[model samples]
Target: MLGRLNHVGIATPSIARSIETYKTLLGADVIGVPFDLPAQGVKVCFIDAPNTQIELIEPYDDASPIAGFLKKNPAGGQHHVCFEVPDIHAAVADMKAKGATILGEPRTGAHGTPIVFVHPRDMGGVLVELMETPQEGAH
Candidate 1:
């Protein structure tokens, strides 16, 4: 099962400006730099929250989901919510068993971690992401 809310993604036009704004507003440390995920057509950066994190995403292509979102809601708002799972593969399997739709198989995400996205139809219209971190001593 997924453990906790990993992070909340916010779509932005400029990740650098968003980082600066978030850092000033939240007084948080920019934990991760914006990295482009060519596979997903988006660039992402992160800032740590109390027990979770804040993720900023920028579209790398006009056809990307964020691009569509920005077109409608130019404010560039919350994109998705992510959950941290102990075992991504098992968690995705469970979600699948529950009739949840997986967007794609697990793959490397920001922070050099493995992750997968769940279709909104299965999650009450809210896009959800499952993230996994290597277990201690799992080498």
Candidate 2:
């Protein structure tokens, strides 16, 4: 079951540029250090907000899926919205039973917790990520 709205994922060509924009334009602070997730094929940075965080993602390589997203959206754009789930396995099962298309199996996400994405078509044309609630003080 869904727990809470977690973070919004934004695809970007350059994390540094995006970070600067967030700071200068949005007056955002408390940005997390950018790190590469080779397996996920993205370089990620988190910009903390009052309620949730903004996940800035840049393609790690040409083969990264984010690269494809960037090709369609050269300036990059909102990629997905993540929601916290009490249990990823249960959430996956529920989604399946509800006729929602799961993008892939649950895997570790930027928050260092199990996550799975639902197809955009199945989620009202918006990609949805379901992440298991992180343990206290993690992330």
Candidate 3:
């Protein structure tokens, strides 16, 4: 079942520029260190907010999915919204039973937790990521 809103993903051409914008414009101060996820093909960083975090994602290579997203929106923009789930497998099953189109199988995400993405068409025009709730101190 759905637990809580985890984070909002934003695709960016440059993580460093995005981080600077967040700091200078939003006064964001709790940004996490940026890291690369070669398997996921993204370089990511998190900016902690009052309620949830903001996930800044940049393509790690031309083949990255984010690279295609950026091509469509050169300036980059909101990519997806992630929600926490109590159980990823159960959630994926529930989505399937409801006729939702999932993009792929659950895999480890930037937060070091299992995650799966639901097709945008199945989620009211918004890409949805379901992430299994992280264990304490996991990330």
Candidate 4:
């Protein structure tokens, strides 16, 4: 089952601008340095939220998955909502048994946690990422 709301993922055309907005306007307390996730095909950063975090993701290149999302909404927008789970494998099995559409096998996420994404259709038109809690950093 899901735990706390882990983060709200926002795909953006410019992560720097997104970081600025969270800092200058929201006054976010913890803004992590952005880093590249070549496997995930995006450059990402985190803006701490009171209860969770805001993950700003940008296309690493035209071939980046986010590139397609940005093409649909040039301004970019909310990409997905992530939730924490105690055990990722169990969660994945449960979701599968329920007939949910899993995107792929659980993999290291931007936060370095084991994470898996379920298709939007199975989640009321919103992509859902289930993350293993107390993320073990990917190195």
Query: Which numbered prediction scores highest in lDDT against the true structure?
Result: 3
| Model 4 TM-score relative to the real fold | 0.92
Q: Is candidate 2 or candidate 4 better by TM-score?
A: 2
How well is each residue in 37-89 modelled by candidate 4, as lDDT tens digits? 99989999988777778999999989998899999999989999999888899
Error of 3 at 111 (Å): 0.8
| Local distance difference test scores for all models | 0.83, 0.93, 0.94, 0.88
RMSD of every prediction = 2.6, 1.0, 1.1, 2.1
Using TM-score, rank the candidates from best to worst: 2, 3, 4, 1
Total backbone collisions, model 3 = 0
Candidate 4 residues lying further than 4 Å off, grouped into runs, are 135-139
The Cα RMSD in angstroms, rounded to one decimal, for candidate 3 relative to the true structure is 1.1
TM-score, structure 1 vs. true? 0.85
lDDT per residue as tens, model 2, 1-139: 3468889999999999999999999999999999999999999999999989999999999999899999999998999999998899998998899999998889899888999999999878999999999998886
Per-residue lDDT tens digits for candidate 1, residues 47-117, read: 87777788899998887768998888786898899888888899889989999889988998775578999
Off by over 4 Å in 2: none
Better of 1 and 4 by lDDT: 4
Q: TM-score for every candidate vs. truth?
A: 0.85, 0.97, 0.96, 0.92
Model 3 pairs in collision: none
The Cα error of candidate 4 at residue 99, in Å, is 0.6
- The residue pairs that clash in candidate 4, if any, are none
